[model samples]
Target: MACKCGGYYYTLNVKASFDRDLNKRRKFLLRNVSVIRMFTSGFFRSKWRSIAGKRRILRLKALTVSLKALKLAGVHGIGIEVWWGIVERFSPFDYDWSLYEELFKLVSDSGLKLHVALSFHSNIHSNNGKGALSLPLWILEIGDVNKDIYYRDQHGFSNNDYLTLGVDHIPLLSGRTALQCYEDFMLSFVNKFESFIGSVIEEISIGLGPSGELRYPAHPFGDGRWKFPGIGEFQCYDKMDDLKMAACREGKPQWGDKGPQNAGCYNSVPSGVPFFEEGKENFLSDYGRFFLEWYSGRLICHADAILAKAAKILKKYQEREQTSVMLVAKIGGIYWWYQTLSHPAELTAGYYNTALRDGYDPVVSVLSRHGAALHIP
Candidate 1:
């Protein structure tokens, strides 16, 4: 067990069992208790009233009284966001899984343990602050706004001014990409719940960036018909980040010969930079550590193709239910904006040394090579 928040650090693992005929009748029979500490939220926004059109009903006794008040407040786990614009809202390989089969049978009859965020963008916001376009309006009426498919920033804004979906026009309108439609929507949502993803679905956050958290969209909002004010820049000027900064300046020629024209290297102390004056090295802290190692190697190649398509659909449901399943990749933390500036001018800030060498150690070293797990609120 381990814990530490606001700076990040969480590790928990528990296992226990007993009862071999009560240990030869000595009389102490506790059997099977394994807890991988997880207590999430997002509760369930009722698909945000089906993206505001309303009438999507599914009040199973108010969702079994809110999963029996999160199993009497112990809350083993619950995170559910699964809204890809209300499960393929109005076509594109049609799908509806009837409100995730009644919220996974009321979260497996309230025994809890289910964490799925898959939400293809839109972390909600709107009240005038923006963000709230959970995509799917026919993927912005069949996209292609000149290929860079959204995400512009550097004052130009884009991402159609908030909400989400435009992570390169979702793999160019599904002809595949956007990590192959997130590994075909996690192998059609684990083959449409093959026995509750082989036993009460444990985790699968994988939302990958912008609110769902990874990076980019450090604030966007431009075409919801204009309305701006501080915040809204980082998005590394699209065109696949200008062909990955022209292949990282063709083998790093001091990242010069002209490259970054906008994506404003997260403003590393601009305005006559001279903070850590004695020897200089700023240039937006070396292009924000080469744009956070090229955006954490393109989000670790889309989290290794979404855990290799969720390990080939959890290996055909663990070869017809022999049991034993595990597929993680929650990832979503990164907020250190130089510990909120100010102090000897935040000790000559470079945005906390570009969030510890380009945003949280290159996204926790490429999501720890794949076992991935992080949710720092």
Candidate 2:
């Protein structure tokens, strides 16, 4: 029988322990790389030259990095995180590519693929990393200037503005409606880096919450210091209709309707309950359920959306450069765990188990299982 979070009918082969065999593992990986290079080089040469070449190079780098990182850590698998705040904050206009460029290269060089966590909050953009994790500054700005559509508060104590997820105007930060900004962001990120990281980085992790929901307990004011910008007005499911309408007007599909729908908001035990009423255990149980539904329901949808984007962009890059490596989504991280800082191991494992029972695949195994078939786009 398949494990709960083990989504597929097939088992992804991963070594249970690193002490099994050193030289044998190296030999196996080497053979895999050689085969991948040969196959990608042949297929991607004529039609998708650029994308194919880039994918191949990326694939090689990703393999090298994953292998190296595991060796350094002395483990067969290591956790990798992609700070979303870092990527999205550096938007296309004012973004700094060098930091990521260098870091990704290091990862590739290290032979470690990242089990990335794409963040939605950015302290740099808010100029308040000290406060509650705020919406990326770009998004706040968009909601601020474009129209008075966001849930806004003028009182100095709590000036946080909340925007309903599906109803808000185009994402101020993304300049597109609701979830459209997220999709575009994914496309742009993949397209820009496909030449570098696409094919090589096989597994990734993503996070999602109540539509435009950034963080729970929208802490706008506490003990005279504001934690988040839009606390009092934090809008969530109340605005789905607006988001769908906006998407229709913009000629985009209304994915919001088809995506996972999180009902009751849950708070975390250690993270301090929102409204200062719901106790920690209550928060955990309720929020856990909320996350369970949201993640499981949208697992395939989210995976398919990102995979499609990656495929499109990879195909383009392969046509141009003919590299071999593929970026794939394995499992998503639980945002609820973000507030619980003490025992990441326990929290991550708990959520991992939860996802397994709910029918999502554990990320590490996905790569190992599909290791052979995965190659340049």
Candidate 3:
């Protein structure tokens, strides 16, 4: 039975101080870039799918009227996800911005600002394709040829939610690295929406990893493969050799090729869990320290690579716009594992946070270098 439970819903669509003048609106949108969850302008909402559900968004007339209402209600503007799957569904570098362009026009005519999320991941895992978008067909075709492009866990459970960081620089997507592909896609977006770059489009939420959050698809919900409260596993195994080589060079040759097995299976609790409980073989051990550091470090490297390219691209646009265009990156759902000393869940999910160390500091430092506002929903 499909649940038609629809009533009031939360939306990131909050109207900033309304400006009737066109130029004034542009400046306001550009200068104010703290766009965050539910009216931050950079939209980081989750409780509600969107103000206009997928079905209504598909209707042009409905979407047009929706924008008008938003403007009337004093909503500064709206943020929409430009899904890679739909835009570049046909081929590489081939983008069709017809729909979004029309949508942008509606916002403009209604005197509202806009922020676009350069969404790169599929929404399949969240709702099992209940009005969800899939990855680009062509890219998935390549994944068929090389499965490692997607994150595969030890139990051989493959999460096709996002591309693994291990293959970020490696050329697997038709002679182009994943990073290159993303760059190309973003470049195409800026070019396509050049008119709205500085004016209406004030902020861009860059999708760093799965579901646009900076984390591995360790405990994925797609197909119900992983249950909640379960310690997830390491993803992007292609980078294992690099970690192994580093370990060997660090006078820990025995650690080569052996990832952390102390992490219990999905649904394992903190108490009595080997790697989770603070004990001899737990995260307090010497081996644990090294492994977790390396694990989180790799994640940061991936963020640095993507955000470096993204920052460069946005900076050029910002210069052209002659206004401060805010760039945002999402790192949502910080775990509150106060019960476990080792924090096995965070360790497996690529966060080395525990009683001893702050795993997020280094990651935040990297984001700071790029001037990206972290959106925590």
Instruction: Summarize candidate 1's per-residue lDDT along 85-160 as a digit string, tens digits.
Output: 6677565767676667766777788787665667666544332434244555556565444435556654554563
Off by over 4 Å in 2: 1-70, 76-80, 88-92, 121-135, 144-174, 178-180, 198-200, 210-237, 240-307, 314-377
Task: Give the per-residue Cα lDDT of candidate 2 at 135.
Answer: 50
TM-score of each: 0.30, 0.40, 0.83
Clashes of each: 2, 65, 6
Score candidate 2 by TM-score against the native.
0.40
Q: Clashes in candidate 3: how many?
A: 6
Residue pairs whose backbone atoms clash in candidate 1: 132-163, 133-163
Candidate 3 C-alpha error for residue 369, in Å: 0.4
Give candidate 1's total backbone clashes: 2
lDDT of 3 by residue, 1-377 (tens): 01111111111221111112324534343333343434523222211123332312345566567667767877776777788887887688878776576667777898877667788888876866776778899988877877778877767666777888877788878788889988999889888887788788877878988878888887786777677767767663653237767788779988767677767666677766777776787677888878777878888998898889988988877666464567887764646464456666677778777656556566556766776766654
Badly placed stretches (over 4 Å) of model 3 are 1-57, 236-241, 319-322
